[model samples]
Target chain A: MSDVTGGGSGADDAADSDDAAGADFDGAQRTGDVPTLSATDVEAGYDQHQVLHGITFESRDGVTCIFGPNGSGKSTFLKTMNGIVPVWDGTITYGDVDLTDEKPEDIVTHGIATLPQGGGIFASLSVEENLNVGAFTVDDADAIAERKAEVLEVFPALEDKLDQKARELSGGQQMMVSLGRAMMTGADTFLLDEPSAGLAPRLVDDAFGLIERLVDRGAQVILIEQNVRAALRLADYVYILAEGEVQFHGPPEDLSEEDELMELYLGL
Target chain B: MVDIGLFTQIVINGLLLGGIYVTIGVGFSLAFGVLEVVDFAVGEYVMVGAFMGAVLAPLFGAEGVFVIPIVLVVFFAVGALIQPLIHHVTTGDRPHPLLMGLVFTFGLATFLRGSVLTIFGPNSQDVPSSLLTGGIEVPGLGTFPVVRTVTAVFGVTGLAVFMYYLYRTRGGMAIRAIAEDRTNARLMGININRYQSIAYGAYAALTGSAGVFIGMTFNASPGMGLQYTAFAFFMVVLAGMGYLPGVIVAGIVLGLTQSFTAVYISGNAVLLVLFAIIYVVLLVSPAGILGKGEWAT
Candidate 1:
């Protein structure tokens, strides 16, 4: 794990710097030009029930994985960032944009795109139509066409199914369409929630591979995952969330050394 | 003692009338399918359209040929204006979307009906018939009225244009996407309010156009709104919600049934049989004839 972080290619570091710089909205002094997504005292919940209890964290570049047991406010945290769930208190800042109280559609325009757990793709729409819808904000037809080609290049399996409806695709393929749709926005930051929730073990790796590609392409990704092993493998920074609060935040190798973290929280 | 020639003519008449029903019903289907709003005031738009055509006929002359475009624009504007308010009421933190839609649209229908009553009074008014007063005689079949033929032609043209717009245009695709999954559509950055307004406006225009055709054939009365509304509802139910092609087929079928029943049986039995058909169709396939599977592609 140390070797993976240490042997990071120059391109990877450059991309990280670019994304980190993009996320530096506060104009705060930093030791390095690291792009970061910061949340301070974020208090939010769904109608009469409070879930997140003033949790705070700063995610810098690369893959920031948030993992927890069921009902640990992981999904809620992602939802709050995506603007699906209203933020009752606290602030969320990404790059030069203050994302607190922003509409979900507006959030996408700010280079932050979100993918929910399931049913993200328009089922009745064709693959081409889905891609078109993904680029709703992009008025230039040529740009949409170019972006679509780029997205399809990443998900080659969908190339042949452009005219096919999204509902007709396999479960893994549907997930791909969802991710591809988010990518079509050309967003710098991606908030993915339980991307591999119902995928087979084989498809799980494929999904992670796509995330790694996004990270490699200079996009900052904050992911919530149930598959701890796969998530830790790809994540640059890991946050262990339990009971609506952060219990651990460090590199994957550091978390692996703590035996209690493995048994108590992770059930490993 | 039923004349076969007369029976043939009745069938032809029914088919033409079905064309008018299709035009009116398509709007209702569109509203139900995409917006998921059962617009109870759909019939009121038809009444308003007929009234507008009647009022404009004398001024425009040429048997209100010019009134069609004017009525379409007016109805479209009215629809666009009212849609946002309806959308807010139906979608605002409501427990049941369908119930909210029903209540809101029902209220709208009542209000519109009252307005028309106050303005037009209870008396039925006639539209100018100078444009399509003649009939074309067929070789084997009986003479077909120029009015029914012209109205049927216009109806078909309207349906074709609407279908083309829905299947071909980017706006149409967005509308279909919303109908499929609204949340996902919003996630894709498709503006829900704007699209809803556009769709409702188009629907109103189509229904209003049907009203012009209806006014030329029959009396334009404030009370006549409910009958067209019933026809549209019956047709939509028969076709299945959100299925465009099915609405067309159902409209024609219902029209034929009404025409044939009115001729052979009794005029009163037209609605009774139509309702019975709707009941049976629902029991057999709750999703309608098209099975509510895909948007009318």
Candidate 2:
């Protein structure tokens, strides 16, 4: 297994070392703030098959990345959090509010927004229109406008293409629109599933940077990524899920120490 | 050789007929486009509207023109009420939404037609109003019936309003988003059921208005529902599923083709020509004229 603090190219090496140092210092004195979201013994699945069985985790106030293999229920776990999938048995709490078996639309009102896989951008709609739809739960016009401005500031590329159809945009640009739309909701916690699923390497870096920026702006970002190495670099905390359960939960440096987890499970 | 005057009359007639087809077909197109459900009872709804206008004409007197609003409201309510039931039955684990919609709405068509037959009998009934029996003479070309011209104007205006609403309004955007992808629309905090019900109501209003026009221009009979239904289906298919503007253009083309065939060939040849056109169009572009296969959901 590669060293957690030193691997990849020069740029990645710098990022990895920085992440490791941050993990070491932060792990010694973890913040006392209440977790934005907590799941306990959460069980969920599609029709007949249960994909997430008795899984549990707590997402603190930063970028928490969930990394796993293909059938490890990472997507299902995100869906369960967003109330798209019903929890067979377990409790999902946002702050102190119980969120078990709630409707997905209602969940947005509680300040939890989700950007599902594939970006979920409305293809036929214009970029501005897509953002408008994202603010559906918000009634005040001024607030929506303010959030739109804030989102545009974060994604300057979308500022020029506000009137263009989302489908006309490139894959990375569409992902920007999707992220921008989610930001328009002004939610404190964002659940992003595979934000960099099919993008060029440079765009992937850009996506990770944007996600990190969200954390800097005081939003709790929970992300699921297939790119293990980049995820370890960007994640403030990491959870390695396999076979519908969490096998390891720690900082990025701790993840590197688990030889079996890094080699066999993650294929790092 | 055809006389220029006669040719002009034929063209005018074709366009006017196309306008009526547009009114009748737009609702069908919307239902299919947004909901992905073929509303087989659209023609029955039209027939119901015509019958309502005919029945209420005497009570409203020459002011029976006021009945249009009432017809629109009542039909919209009826559509909203029935849509949920249709959605519930067709959207579960048993069968695909399209197949279930076809079976359910086909049954609804038969039920509605039977109800009309039971109430009004098989005889065709004419709507008794000045709005129905009048004409305006045009210079050089010919005189056109006031009812047909009014119907055409209203149809075009309604279609224009619907198009604007779909592309510009928030609610319309929600509907279009749902049409594009139901899961994503829901994720965006759009209540899919409410929007779908509203869409059904809007569709009903359009078809009901078309029925009133049909009743005023032609006589209303229970069996005429099937003919209008067939024509609406043809227009929708020709325009391509979910392509709104294409439906309007296709309606005009179909109307013109039908009119020209009836005048030059025979009235019976209209269906034959329509089927042949549909076959050729499907063979060449399975997505219809302007359809890019984007709104498959």
Candidate 3:
């Protein structure tokens, strides 16, 4: 290990491809090297039936990738991160803050932006409009313009499609816009659910490249993806989930290679 | 098969009547568009505005023309408040908001109507008008009611302003975008609840204006809501809920059809014949003549 789980100065860390875990928090207050995200015995469900039964997990820093089959409560877990789903028996805390009870809108203001699975762009709105709308927390007009320009720089494909309706774009382009929309908020943590879903093989590669760029830019990425091999290669740490429980959590190298982990969960 | 002047009168009246229909239809459509539920009590809300105008016109010495803004402001608040309450009561994991909204608003409507009956009495109250009394004389055509002409102008102007706000203003764009796709809009940080309130407010303004016109043209009574409710509902679904321009046309066509039917057929048979024509039209164009299918999607 390259100490990918640490936090540091964030300047040089952002410049370098290394984890630079301590560098992300080197400024004034020494609030520990790794950021804390905890779900303490959470039981979430619909009206009557509980889908998530007392689930608990903790992530220090860097990308914490969650892998599971379709019905293993993966989407529900992601929704709970931003308070989309109510916690039945557990609490989610970021540092000292109790985020388990906050509203979804309030969660976004706290630097946690959720890029929901599928193309979450406003289908009828233009690409520029969609991106601008995403900057809902940014109040100052000048700041909004600056962020819009900056995001466009990061994703050049969105630049030319500014005036085009989001629904008119291809699935991959829509995903790019979705990322651009989320990037507008300057979120420190990303709760991405299956960014590669429904994307063609070529677009998936491009989208993965974009994700790498995001991780390189000093944002902590939490990806919940089905593509086990790709996720293992990209993620510093991995958590394997089955039947609404965490069966394994550690460095990707610790897992018995890609095929072994697949056979354990997929029964292939 | 009738006098040319009478035919012309029917046509003009139909057009003017259509303007009022457009105003009411727009309110109904906007409420449904934003909230995914029809304010079934909207008919009563219109009645409330009409009664408000009826009561205030006598006190302020203001006619129908001036009472619009006051009625609009009052009803806008009413719309905003009522929408959230409906959302609170019936919004949690309900499959059919339309059905729940209808049931809830219908109860509200009944309560409002009973309140009006108890306070204002069953007898109809008159709303005096001065601004739209005289007719505008054209060269060949006979004089048209000044009120009817102005209402038509209000109809077109209201739609123009509404459409502009929906496309041009930041707030308006947010509303339409949210209406089209709520989850995506939420991801963009558009406050769903706030924009929904604004949409309800706009609905109130439209229906409030219709109420004012109703008061100016006819007497206000507890039963007035029922009279307009059926027609307003027909126009909304007939024009297709999402088609703004189509709603306007549908309103006008509905008015004209009613007027012509009343002229050629028996007064008692007018509604029956008009509804028949509407059913035929709906059958021919399931999405309403100019309406699109994407609105439902």
Candidate 4:
């Protein structure tokens, strides 16, 4: 497991001790410091057609926003994080192990959880049953019970809707369940693809708020968003992708005045 | 003029026969629901169970009553082991589940039949002294064979136990979730491979039980697999795959239809009529009576 957040800020210093002793793939050892995931010059694509060209980035202890227009490979980039889509080149290191060729199950071992773009919840399963599945990797009954309580507390709406079939939930609520289910894995890092996609403005705000709160709890978030302005507001670091390549990589403050970014990337 | 007593006996026999039909169809239904895999080789499993019962029957002296439990356990184990092979092929990302599972299981069925022939020889075998020794007269409805009554008991008990296992247990819920949406279930941490294997294993066991039931009532032969295979498929299609209760009802209905036809028409003609009814039912309700979702193309 490669330490994704190892090189970020000063957080890595405090995480160093815990990473030395704790399971390499368990939740973050040091809440606000240790790096959770890192991708270095990663080249990934679909069926021999490359989509991400030499993508390099890192997420440490807070939300790292990825905003790009359509066909910029945002979803593809997210898939590579979990090895759902293989990396053709470069290395993706989670915690201390290299994940360039690891299976998706192995990726989960590194304490990184993913909630893919849309319709990720099991349609036929009742809401609570879906939540139970999130704890599948956890074998202990007590631990599963504790995690379920924790998840329901975070998303209290799910408590009342436990028996309802998941497909019956509103799109926004479904997204919450998807994220909450990922949280059940006790993963330190989250790979969220367009959490705001197809959501109403109010629901988008709710989704963004949830991401902010997760980051506040010392969880690392790698977010792929089409809502560029809203994402920048919540992100600590930003990467602008264009046609499978990184157009800009810096703090949000640096790109605040770039008129060309708004015209070409944001289309404002 | 028909003998009312004989008619009564035939009806009772048909009901007992339907019980076995339901067991066979239930296994087929679960296999399709979980893996979208059609188990053409299911009949072979039943054949194996029947032969195993026949072999065990003789060991228990002249009466095979003691061999019943032994056969169930042995056949259940056999089903569990054979399930992995079926899963191995159907696990691939292919759309033609029926074609793949059907063709592969067919090959397996042939191999099993050949093996049975080699071991048991090409001969029909049965339990010694008959599992049912005598019949008791009903006040108004003629005498019913004690063994046939026991067969019905086994059938209904099997269905009851299967239903309880599927709906009441934690593992059962997991299986239902997988059957509904495999990809989402996997994301939620449902080990697709583990649950699927168990489902297949259970299917095998169910088929085995049905086989043993059939063997005790009728003669066990390698060729018998074909008839049961066709009947099970018909029952599944008629009852709808995945709906266990519906399959049971369909099995009984099929049994009654066959019995009534056998009384008035040729045995071969009975099959034709049954298939004709099945076709009409499918035309009206494509998913079978209580199938999942709306009708299909």
Q: What is the C-alpha lDDT of each candidate?
A: 0.80, 0.80, 0.75, 0.75
Best by DockQ: 2
Q: Candidate 3: deviation at residue A156, Å? A: 2.9
Please give, for residues A1-268, the per-residue lDDT of candidate 2 as tens digits: 0111122224554565544343221111223332468899999988789899899998966888898899999999999998888899999998777889788877776667788887889888899999998888777675567568767877888999999999999888898888888876656678999988778777999888888776766677899999878877778899888999998898888887889888878898
Docking tier of model 2: it is medium
**Least accurate stretch of 10 residues (summed lDDT) in model 4 chain A?**
A1-10
Candidate 4 on A1-268: residue-level lDDT in tens?
2234341224454665555343222333447654457889988887657899999888855778888889998788888888678788999987677878876755764567787777477766778877776766655565466567767877888999999998899887897788777877766788888878778788888899988777765688998988887887888888888888889978878788787986898785
lDDT head-to-head 1 vs 3, winner: 1
Per-prediction DockQ: 0.51, 0.55, 0.43, 0.32
Q: In candidate 3, which residue ranges exceed 4 Å CA deviation?
A: A1-36, A59-62, A257-261, B1-9, B266-270, B295-297
Give candidate 3's error at residue A157 in angstroms: 3.0
Please report, as a residue range, the 10-residue window in candidate 4 chain B with the lowest summed lDDT.
B288-297
- List runs of model 4 lying over 4 Å from the truth: A1-35, A41-54, A67-73, A86-90, A97-102, A196-202, A226-233, A240-248, A253-268, B1-11, B59-88, B91-98, B118-122, B136-144, B291-297
Residue B108, model 4: lDDT of 86
Scored by lDDT, model 3 comes in at 0.75
Compute the interface RMSD for candidate 3.
1.8
* Strongest candidate by TM-score: 2
